[model samples]
Structure formats: structure tokens, C-alpha cells
Target chain A: MTAATARRDFPRAYGKVGSLHRERLWALRLSYTSLIVAAIIFLAPPVYMLMTSLKTNAEMADQTLSPWLVRSPTLEHYGATLENPLFLGFFANSAIVTLLVVSITMVISVLAAFALSRMRFWGSQTLATGVFLTYLVPDTLLFIPLYQIVGGLGLLNSIWGLVLVYPTLTVPFCTWIMIGYFASIPKELDEAALIDGASWPQMLLKIFIPVALPGIIAATIFAFTVSWAAFVYPTAFITRPEEMPLTIGVVSQLVRGDTFAWGQIMAGALLAALPPVVVYVFLMDYYIAGLTAGATKG
Target chain B: MSEVNLRKVVKLFEGGVQAVRGIDLEIADHEFCVLVGPSGCGKSTTLRMIAGLEEVSEGEIWIGGTMVNDIPPKDRDIAMVFQNYALYPHMTVFENMAFGLKLRHFPKDEIKRRVDRAASILSIGELLDRKPKALSGGQRQRVAMGRAIVRDPKVFLFDEPLSNLDAKLRVQMRTEIKKVHQAVKTTTIYVTHDQVEAMTLADRVVVMNHGVIEQVGPPNELYHHPATIFVAGFIGSPAMNFIPARLVNAAGALTIQLGQGLSVPVPADRTARYAPHASKKLLFGIRPEHLTETTRTDKQNLAPITVDLDVIEPMGMETLVHFRIEGTPVCARVDPAAGAQAGAPMRLAAHMDQMHLIDADTGRVL
Candidate 1:
């Protein structure tokens, strides 16, 4: 049936004149109130952060009522933070580790998830549920045990050690996302590929991976953000000044016997937070799509 | 194109549920064979088994005289059009058609040539670069057919490819698919529940019930002389009316007595077939089209049929009268020109020449 015919068949009921006008006014009032409340609640912290990042170390200490709009906005703090060689090294180190971790997580999860979602064998259902549940286990609970394992492996004070440990956290979550994505692909598409003379590997690489690209992007964002913002593991495993990831590397150097570089510290934090923020800006659609797949496909 | 053959093929699923009971079939090269039945009657399972998508729990399948029991679907040399038109959603029509050839490492030019040829045949040339998501349902169905045709496989398997289409588009695609089959002439097997599709498309229709083949024959054979009661009932729209009766000999001719002071003569040729089984309870089968409005002059052979017209459905060319008889509900197709009325007595002339009689107990033709 045509949409026009369907519309004619089930005509929309019109509200009475009094209620219709009342509803419009009521909806407008509610929308305006929510927008104002939301703007303040959500934008307040980031605006404050922007003000703090703009201030000099002395201005930050000065108690002022209107701290949000800096009277004299200066780029000195940005310059100061950008000038530190050690800070630059930390930034580079975070980039390398997060990129490697995201790449590794995506590759491994895509393969593992395709297998778990598509291939059938004994214990497959158990193994898939087990993987998703593993992601649910709090990372903090395993930090001590994981630290001990890293110590035993003699991977202390190394970025490689952080890279190795990051996958343990990212793989399960990313694989879970990918499993849902791969499962949502209609079973017929793969059957078509299989009958098209594609082997299992070909089916995954050619058909599934391309079709589930949104999920892959979401998985990558999750892996990259988790690796970039990881504070506990890097702090526990890397003690050497040169070995620290940027999150720890910046904070540890900002303190010199309690005489902290507050301006540089916020600057470094802002810089360290930039990549994930940028990633979300570029791929928010896929991130939201991938997240919803878990709820719907499950 | 290869002739497809199955020898006692059975598919017992993981939970020991037999989706397809033992089935044996053979299709000659370039023949359009339709496996048709109601949903979950093992028709799709049988097609999937022949495509090597499902494993045979027992027996063997041969495509082009090669035993393919252990082979994966990729090596089976078959192309299947799924009910959902399983075109790769991510790819354009060109890529969807080219994927199989690209996987086989077909030369780029050769792949393009084959795809273009199939596209022209399907008249989807203008839509080649559009993704399946961008196309209408009928366009997507044509793209799916184009994809199958580009493969040039040994056999073509269609699993109700037109089920998703609207009625008008379905009828159009039905003819389109038939024309494609005629042009390609690949050994084809189509599965559908609509008997009209089976009758119009198949060189031979395999009617199934409860995972078992009820009957297999040409469409006309099935319509005129069904091998069993299920086939008789399932093969016609406004299905064959089965009236309970008793077979008896009256004055040297076979006659069926309907209990309600109504008796009709059976065909003379079929008299000998039921002679050995006289006085047995039988199910008298007759198609709706074979029953005409009884005129006074033709009352000699007409059986008395009383129907309390519950509903009247007019389809332009004919009118359908649904009512009850012998305490059992039945449908009769009658001429619209006769202007049958609701809640009124309508006399029907049950044509005895085309009437069928079967043993009600065993459901076998007597």
C-alpha cells in the first residue's frame, strides 16, 4: 500500500482547539526550561576548564567571583606547556601506545568476534557470554593481579608493557561490541558469500568487516580512549621518568616537591584529552550506533 | 547447467528434529523444478540441502553426476536467490554481482562483461552503482537475480524470491524470473507455498507435507489427478472440496452416495479401480471450477448440494461462495454472472466426470 493511502485509512486525530493551544504553550515552556538547565549543567565544567587553562598560575590562586570569563585571556600557559620537552615526549608516547592498542584491539576483536558470532562449535555460546561478562568485571579489581603479572614478566617501566596490558582490557569490550555488530548482519548475506565461492576468511574480510565498519570504528574509539586515559596501570607499572605514558608523565612532572606547575598541568591534561575528544567529534554517529547494537541485537 | 539429483536425502537437525524426512528427486538439465508446500514443510530445507548449505544427515546428493556430500557450499556450483533478496547491503549492485567472480579471481574485464550482460538482461543497468538500501523492493529483487545470473553456475536455486514483493510486483517478477530461466536455461529449482507459482513456473511440482513428499508430478497431472488427498487439497486455491461419501454400485455403474438423498455417478474408466473396494467410506474431491450452477435439464447428473451462503467474495471474473455442507465448511468457485445471493438456496452442479474419489481412511486414490 502507498503511504498516502495508509495515511488516509488511519487519519490522525486532531486535538480540540483549547487543548491544542494549551499543549503548544506547555511544550514550549518545558523545552525552554530544559534547554537552559541542560546548558548550565553540561557546559559549566568545560567552560570552567577553559577559564582555568587560560589563566596564569597566579590568577588561578586569586579568588574571583567570575572565574569563567578570564578578564585578560592569555596564551602564556599554552606556550609554557607546549615548550616542555619532557611533556612533548609524554604526548608522543601516549599517541604511540594508544594507536598501537587501538589497531591491535580492532584486528584481534574483529577476527575473534567474527569467529564467535558466526562459527559454530561446542561452547561457542558459553565463550561469547563469557567474553562480554569479562568486560563487565571491574578493571580496578584486577589492577593488583595484573600489576603482579606485568612485574613477573619483567615488563616494568616500559611503554611496551602498557601496550601489552591495554589489550587485556580493550579486547574483551571491543570484541563484545563487534560480536553484536557481526550478529546483526543478516545471516543471508554470509550465506550468499559462501555460495559465491568464498571461504570463511573471505566471507569475514570481504563481506562482514566492510558491512560492520561502523561497529569497528566504535570499537576503535573505545579502545583508543581507554588506552589514552588509563591512569592506574601506567602509574603502577612505569616508575622511570622516561617510561611514563602522558597521563602519568604530565602529572608526575608537574609536581616538584609540592611546588606544582598548575598552568602546565592543566595544559598537559587538555592536550592529553584532545585525541579522544577529536575522535568522538568525527565518529559520534558510529559510536552511538555501535553502543545501541548491544541493546537491540542482544 | 547440470542435472540435480537427490537420493533419500534427510536432514535431522542438532536436536534430532527431522526438518526434511527422506526425499528423493531428480531434475533434468535446464528444467524448472519447483519444490512447493506450506511453510515448514521441508521445501526450503530440501533446496538448501541441494545447494549444500545444509548437510544431509542421511543419503547423498549429486550435481552434474558428482557426489557433493562432503563438499562445502562454495564448491557446489550453485546460485541461490533468497526470499529477502540477500543482496550485499554494503555494496552497489555492480559489486554485489561481481563479488563471486572477484573471489574466484576472474579477470577484471571478464567480470565486467558478465555483470553487464546480466544487468542488461535484468534491465538493471541504470541501477548498477546504487546500493541495495537505495533501491526499491522490486529493483532489489532484480539486482539479486542479476547477481545470480552473473555466476553462471550449474544450477539456479530460488527460495521464494518474490514473497517480499507486493502483489502486482510479485506477478511481474514471476514472469521476469521465468523469462530469465528461459534465456539462461540453467537447471533451476524454485520453492514457494503459492500453488499458482508452482503451477505456472514448474516443469514438475513437488508437493510436500510434514517434511515428507506427498506427491511429485507435472502441474497438470497434480491438478487433474493428485496422487494423495493432501496433494489434492494443497495444489489448488480455494482448495479442492472433499465431501465425505460412500462408494457403491448402482445399476452396473459406480456411484458415490452423499447420505443426504444425493448420489452422483463416478467416471466409467475409474469404476474398475474402486470395484475391489466397494461399500467403503470415501472422500469425494472436486475443484470449485468443476462445480457449475445446476439447471433443470442438467439435474440428472447433478448432486444436491445445500450451502447457507456465509460470505460472498467477488474477484471480477468469478465469485467465491464460502458455506457449510455435511457439517464441514467448504468453498466453491462459481460464475459471477449467476449473481448468487447470501443466505439463499443455490443449487450446484458437481461435474461427475472431473470428480475424484479416495479412501477416506488411508487417503489414497481408489
Candidate 2:
């Protein structure tokens, strides 16, 4: 039966107000209002960033023009930022570090999750909980100790230092997400594969990986975003402009002793944010599916 | 050659819960055997041990004369269909059927031929290109069976595969599975809690309860001659009624005395057998169909009883009337035209020819 007929048969659930419950509509209106307010509050900064990136330096400094509006917009700041080789070098460094970090994190996390969830030994349960607990630790507190390890390796002023320390930020949470996905797969599927004549590695590659693709995509997006935008590790280790990622590179290079080039800084920041935004736009469905995997039956 | 033998098989889970306690069974080649019982009765556990999914804790499992206790599931040459129809969500139905062959490195053309043949057997040819998520529940069940049939393994195992389908679809698939097994002629072992499915599909039904086998025989034999009270009650629908009574020697004829001073004489042929238990308190077991309206004739063992009908249910072809025998509830399946009604006295003919005398202390039928 349709829900409308069900509501008619069970009318007390709709209350004495009939099919259109006034109290329900009021609750719905309040929820939508709060959702709209939350959306605007979260979106204001990006919208303002785009406006500033389009504005000319003269328009930005003018006392009469509103900072929110870009009157007589120019692409001069964008063109100048692209032409600067120092800016391009920082972008390349961030891209390479993110690529390496994400790959390393996925390898470690998938193997760790498969072992922790399926291959049981002593203390396996405790180890799985401990992996998630590490993700809860704030990275701000970790960067100080990680600096010593990176410095002890004699790699203080290098981009490799960020690559070395970034997995500590990404692996714990990615493994935690992967463990949830792996555990949710019914035990029968693996048994069915085993009966179908698949070895353990074959089952992992052909069955588990394809079945858990959404979780892997979600973890990849997380690792990419976290490594690309990471600031504490790079700032603590690398002082050279060429060794810096986009997060520390743009801020330290653009602002000089309170002489802030607001327009160029905004343009450079927007350019650096393009990759992750594109990733989210293309894979938003899978990301949401992965996050809500254990909350409901698929 | 493909017969299966379980010699004293046992499965003891951690912390001392014995799921299957040293049960022995022999399934002949190409015979459809169903292990049926209530939940947690070790029926599914027995099927899993044969499939090599569960380790045999204490005994030998021989399949095709090969003593497969050490063999892995892949090397054991068996295919299983799970209850949920564990089709890979990402692969098409054709690919799902071809997975076992692909894993074992069969040639591409050979895999395609086998998949096509199995699809035709299940009539799922049109659905071969669709993923499992796109199919209905019945369609998924068909694909799961198709996956098993494509392998041409020595034996087929099904673990309550039809429990997920609706009633109508389950019956349809039941006929489909029997047809497939007949065409393929593979030894098969099926597990289910449904007695009707067991009776309809199996060549021999194996009834299990609490980690042990209760009885194993053909369906007709089990219904006509159950060895114990559990089998007598578990086999038939509306179930067999067990009324408490006493066996007495009444002037050289053995008669059973029920609680309401109603006495039923044993048939003359059973006099020698029941005379030994003449003074023992026993349970008189009679099926509902055997206790009907007082209209049946030509039976020398017919005995009459008057009962006040407490509830009468007209079920189109047959009417089920519930009555009491000295405070013990008894059901009778009479013809719908027998004029049975509630709060009225009715006369029922008890077929003493089919009556069973049981030792109440031991639950064994005599």
C-alpha cells in the first residue's frame, strides 16, 4: 500500500488536524530555515574569496567601493600569480606531496584494515580501536614530536619531510574508515568466493576491492584534502619557499610585514583549491555513500 | 562415486557450545538429502562442514571416496547457494556465473558456453546482463542457483536458499530447483527449517535436534512410522496430538483408558505388541486428519468420542475444529460439509488403526 493510504487508515498518527498536520509543517519550516541559515554561514567565505580574486588592486583599496562586490573586475592578479615561477614551484611541490601521501596512505590502510577486520589474532580488537583513537589526536599536538623525527633524519629543509609526516595525519582515519567498510561485508560473500575457487589474494583483489570501491574513494578524497591543505608539519620543518606546499607557500610569500596583497593572495588561494573541489564535484555521491555505510543497511 | 559420508562429525564452538555432536550420515550419489530442524539445531552447521566452510572438529568427511577432511572448499568440488543469494553486487549475472571458472583459469570460450547453458536451465538468459542490484528478489535467487549449476561440480549445497523469497516465489523456485537437480543429476544436500520444503524436495529427509540426528528416512516412511515423539510432532502440519492415557488389560483385549473414562480398544493385530505395555501410562499420538467427523466407514479400528467444539475454522476444502479431551486441547480436520460449529457437541471418529503409543518418559514411539 502507498503511504498516503496508510496515513488515511491510521489517522491518529496525523493527529486531529487531518492529512496536513499543522505542527508537522511548522517543524518542517523551522528545519528548512535552520538548514538555509547553515548553508549561507558555511558558503559566505568562498563566495567572498571569489569576489576578492576578481577585484583590481585600486578597487580593493578604494574607501568608497564595498569589499563584497567586484566592480570593474580584472584578471591581472590571476595572470601575475600564474606567471610567477616561485608560485608554480610551490604548486608542483604540493601536488607531488599529495600524490605520494595519498598512495602511501591507501596501501597502508587497506592492508591494515583487511588484516585487522578479518585475520584475527591476539589483541586485534584492541589494535583496531587504537587506530581510530590515533585519528582523534589533534595534529597540532603531534607536529612538535614529529618535527624531531623528521629533523633527526637530516631532512629538515625538504619537501620529503612533509611526505614522511603526512601519513601520520591520514593513515589512522583512512584505516578506520576502511575497517568499517570491510567489517560490514557479510561473512558469506568471502565464503562463497572461497567455494568458487579463489585464493585469499584473489578474493581480496577481485571481490573485496571492487565491492568496497566507494569507501576507498571516500578515503582517497580525505587523504588528498588533508595532505594538500596541511600546514603545521610543513611550517615546522621547511623554511625554504621551494620546499613549501601551497598552504604555507601562499601565506608566507604574499603577506610581507603587514603589506598584504589581498587580491593576489585570494587569487592564488582559489587556484590552489581547484583540485579538491573538482574531486568532490565528480565523486560526491560515493563520498556520501561511504560516510553513511554503517549507519543504515545499503 | 559422489556419495558423501560423515562419520562422527562434530562442531564445538569456543567456550564449550557443541553445535553438532558426533552425528553420522551417508548421502548416496545423486540423492537429494535435506537436513531439517528448528533454528540452532546444527542443520546448517552440518552442511557447512561438508562444504569445508567449517572445520570438522572430530571426524572424517568423505566425498566421492576422497576423505576430504583436509581439503579446502575449492578443491572439494562443491558449489553452495547461500540464503541471501550472495551475488557480487558489481558484476553482471553472466559474470557471476563465470567467476568460479575464471578463478580456476578456464578458457574464455568454455566459460561462456557453460554460463549460457546454466542460464538456459534457469531461464535467466534475458537477465544475464543486469547486475544483482537491478534484479528483483526472485530473479536474484535464480541467478544464485545458476551460479551453482554452471560449475558442474560433484555435489550441490543449498543453505536455506528459498527462505528469503515470498511464499509464492518460494514455491515456484522449489519446483525450479528440483527440475535443475533432475536435469543435472548431481548429489545435493539442502538445509532448511521448513518441513514442507523438506518433504517436497528431498529423496530422504534428515531431522536434527539439538546437535544430533533424530531420524533419517523417506518422507512417506517418516510420516507413517515416526520413531520418536519429536519426529511424530515435527513432521505434520496442525501437528499430531498426544493425549495422556493408560494402557489396561480389559478381559484379554488391550484397551487405552483416556482421562474422561473413554476407552479405545487396540486393533486385534496390535494386541500382541501392546500387551507388553498393558499397565504403563503412555501418550496416545494421533494425527489431526485421522481424527475426523464420524462419517468414515470400512475401518475396523474406528472408535467414537463426543466433544464440545470450542473453535471451528472453515478452510474451504477442510474444516478444522478445536475441542477438548478432559482439559487437553485436540484438533480434528473434518470435511467442510461436516456441519461443525462452535459451542456445540460433535461426534468424531478416531482412527485407532493409525494410533501410536509412546513411552512418555523416553519420548519413544511404540
Candidate 3:
């Protein structure tokens, strides 16, 4: 009401606004800095791979050539990797194995998750936990037994060997993720469906499967990435290049006796990693949501 | 329409939790029966048993004269509306309403006709194309009801379907549900914790508590003549005020003695009812509305009492006056214009004929 007090209040109000502005600026600066740092950390390996894939073989061999710079950018390595019958075979094998494993994982995991979560059978909870615990078992520990089993089945040098072993790694974790997603769904939806004349399988197909698409996508991504990048089982089971998945095929066939075809290897690795990366880029929200939904709900 | 009969049905959940214990109820065809109780009182479990959702652990459930103990819910010919509405989030309202009919392989035109008819009945016709996420809570509830209505099943089950809406919307939906039920004339079993909803919607109210059915009668019957103390306490808002008293026969008169020289005469009609328990401790149950400011015209069944007021809550039309009668707190719903004040002595009268005397030890109404 007085001029003197009004002037004092004006500066106090300005100070409050100034402090809020500074706080907002600090938050923005901190987020931007951390984002850039994270981007560099995550992008560095892929960027290096792309650069290596573009380098000429001569430049890669030159000792003075900077590893990060492709002085002579060439599509020669991509062309070579694509044209090589061995690389093409490995790529085809990986694609088939990944597709089969993903489909099998989704079907088995969806049904298992539905039963374990919704059906109130004896020991269902214990069985669900057991599935998750099976996933927690390290793959290295099971490789020897798995090897004997695969050999005993007389599929030692077959792509089917990898398919059989891949599910062992994919199904348990995928089922666990699905169980969490299914459990997070309100129980009433399934009950309502049941009252609406849906049998158990019908309920899963009509309601649970459609409602839990994000979790399914997340599980699919996990299954595909794991099946595509599988190394231990393929290396242990298949010594033949024809049956080796892309991961083992590339590493075994390209680097012969310590003479590394660095450009072609990087090119093959980059190409192999493309599917999952593209999947993640497009479905990042669903991936994170599914993962966190599993953790929190479970 | 078909009758739903539960013959001593019991639900023993895992770890020996008995949710519904021996509930024997027969809902006649086209009767609107409501199972009302407090939380954990097995009302919802009873409805679920009739719907074939929860397995009847120890008894037989008969719907339309057929024992349904071994039948799955899908074959039971009943439709249920869940408290959460349970509208499929991914489906449009039309899809949700048509799901049951499609499952039964009804003709597409028939399914459409049923859905449109039910949607119009619930006044949710325009929302048929919208997904459940795009609708409000009340709209979703209407869609849930529509989903059930389109089935034209033998029985309809509602598991506290209106519990999730706001107060105003809940009342509005309550009336809409009543209207829908009246129009369809299907045997319906509704469950809710709110007694008001039960009283308003049910032709017969089954009051349950502690896994047991305490009383089953018309809504007014349950309110006016509750069989147990729990029913009396559970079926009213602001609840019935219970005062510790003793029925004493002294000098050829029947009266209930309050503490510290306070007594109210029992009505002559109830004199013989209280005569046998003359010396026993009892609970005197009086609803708040029965206690009011003493007026000159009040003569029959109005026993005047004076007490020091503790608090006053004016609820628009009526003011709730809190007071202590011989160290026991009691509330009287008085005229708001009576200008009752806190900490002031107020003259009030308890309606003697409406008072309930319960055996203190067994909690059964006398």
C-alpha cells in the first residue's frame, strides 16, 4: 500500500522468480549433460563398428591409420560380406533359428504365464518362481549337460541343435516376464471373460494375449536378441560352418588362425546387430515399460 | 428367467480361510436379491459362487433347477459386472458388448441388434465405437452393464459394480441399474458394502457377516427387525448408537435402566418380550433419527431425557446432536432449526417403540 514497501516487495518477488529460473536452468543443464554423456557411452561401440565396416582393407592394415577414422570409405566390405556364400549361409541360419526360437518362446511362454498366473492350481506360485529360478541358472553351467544331450539326440551338427538349446535360455525368462505382465492384469477381466462364456484358452487368446501386447513385444525382443547372439551352445555343439549361427559363423570363419579380417568382421557384426537395434529404437517405450512392469508387479 | 438357489454353499479358500460358510439362499425367478455386508463378510464370495466364478468348496449351487457344482462358468448362462467394470481396455464398447454373443456364435445381425438394444437401454449408444480408455468411469460402468445385458442370460451378477464411481455418479448409476433390471426382469444377485445401494436396489436383502448369512428379508424387514446386532449396526449410516443398559422389572413395571438413575419405559407391546430378560445386561439400540428434540405435541412412545451436549454436526436438513447419557455417548438427529449448541444441556426424547434390545453376550436381537 505504501511506495517504500511496494518497492521492497517488488525485489522480493523478482528474487523468487530469479531463483526459480536459476533452478530450472540447472536442471536443464544437468539433464542435457548426462544425456550427452550417456549417448556417447552407448553409441561409441556401434559408431566404431560402423567406422571399421566402412574402412578400406588397406587402411585397416596400415599401422598409422587412425582406427576411429575411415580414410577411404568403401562399401567393399559390405559387398564382400553379403556376397560371401559362407556369410550368407550364416545369416540365413541365424534368421531361421531366431524366428523359430522366438515363435516357440512366445507360444510356450504365453500359455505357461497364463496358467501360472490365472489358474489356481496347487503349487502354481512355486512353479512360477521355479521358472524364474531356472532362468537365473548360468548358461555356462548347463553347456556341458546340454552338449551331451544334443549329441545324444544325434543332432550334433544341426541348426536344430541351436533351436532346441536356445529355448532353454529364452523360455524361462520370457515366461517370467509374461507372468508378471499377466498378473498385473486385473483378475476381473479374466473372470468377466469366463462368465462371458470363454474357456481358458479362449480367454488367453481373446483377452490376455491382446491386452498384454507390450509385454509380448518385450519378450519377443529378448528372445530374438538372445537367439541371434547365441554363442556358447552353437560353438560347443556345431563345429561345421554350415550349421553355425551368424555369431559363431562370423567369428570362426572370418578370423582364421589369428589373421583377423577386421573390416569384414565388423561389417558382419554390425549387420547381425541391426534387427534388435532397429526393434529397440522403434519400441523403446514398450521395452522399458514391460521390463519395469515385470519388476514392480512381480 | 430362472431361479438361483444355493444349498448350503461354502467357500474354503487356501490356508483355511472360509470366505462363505454354508450360505443357503434361494432367489426366485425375476427377483432382485442383494447381498450386503461389510468388507470381508463373504457377500461377494456368495455372488461369485452363484456366478460359478469361485468353486463351491463344500456345497451345491443350483441355477434354474440344475446343480451347477461341476459346470464351468461359461456353461452357467450368467453374466457378471465386476466392480472395476472390467471393460477390455483394447476393445471398443461394441466389441465388449458383443463378446459374449460372438463367443456363443450368434449371427452377426443378432449380436448387433442385442448390443444396440442394450446400449440404448443404458443410454450409452454413442459410446459404442469408443474404446473403454476414452470413456469416463460412469460410461464404462454403463458399458459393463450393457455387456452383461446383451447376453440375455438366465441370471445377472453384479459385484459392487457402482462402487468405483463418485458419490453423485454412484447414485445416478444405481438408479440406472435398477431401471435396467426392471426392464430385463432377470434374476439378479447384486453385492455391495454400501447398505444404501442395497436398500435402494434389492427386492430382498441378504445381510452377511463373518462368512455367515445373519439375516435375509426385504430391505425394510432387515432395517426394522434386524435379527442380529451386526445387522443393526451395519445397515445404517452414522450407524445405530448402542447404549449399555439393563432391563429391570420393578414394582410391576417394565423399564430399561440406564446408568446413574436414568430409565426409559419399554413400550407395552414389547413389555412381555423384555420381561424374561428383566435382570440381564442388554444393548439398547436406537437409530439417530429416532432421537429428536422434545416437542409439545410428542406424546406416545416419546420418553424425554436431558443430557449435556458434546458436539453438533448440522447436516443441512437435520442437525446431529452428540451427547452423553450416563457416560455413554449417543447421537440424536434433531431439527436443524432447533439451534442445539455444543456443551449445552438439550432436552430430547427417544422413540421407545423403535428401540432394539439385544442380548449383550450373544449379540442377538431380542
Q: Judging by DockQ against the true structure, name the best candidate.
A: 2
Which residue pairs collide in model 1, if any? none
User: Per-residue lDDT of B96-146 in model 3, one digit per residue for the tens?
Assistant: 999999999999999999999998899988988999999999999999999
C-alpha lDDT (0 to 100) for residue A186 of candidate 3: 90
Worst 10 residues of 2 chain A by lDDT: A15-24
lDDT of each residue in B245-265, candidate 2, tens digit only: 898887788888877678888
Residue-level lDDT tens digits of model 3 in A233-269? 8889999988888899888898868899988999999
Off by over 4 Å in 1: A1-21, A24-32, A35-39, A294-298, B251-253, B295-308
The lowest-lDDT stretch of 10 consecutive residues in candidate 1 chain B is B295-304
Candidate 2, A41-62: lDDT as tens digits: 9989988988988998888889
- Please report the candidate that would top lDDT against the real structure: 2
Residue pairs that clash (backbone atoms under 3 angstroms), model 2: none
User: Model 1 over residues A218-274: C-alpha lDDT tens digits?
Assistant: 899899889999998998888888787888988898787988877777777888778
Question: Of models 2 and 3, which has the larger DockQ?
Answer: 2
**How close is every model to the real structure, measured as TM-score?**
0.94, 0.95, 0.94
Worst 10 residues of 1 chain A by lDDT: A10-19
Off by over 4 Å in 3: A1-21, A255-258, A296-298, B296-299
Q: lDDT, candidate 1, residue B353?
A: 69
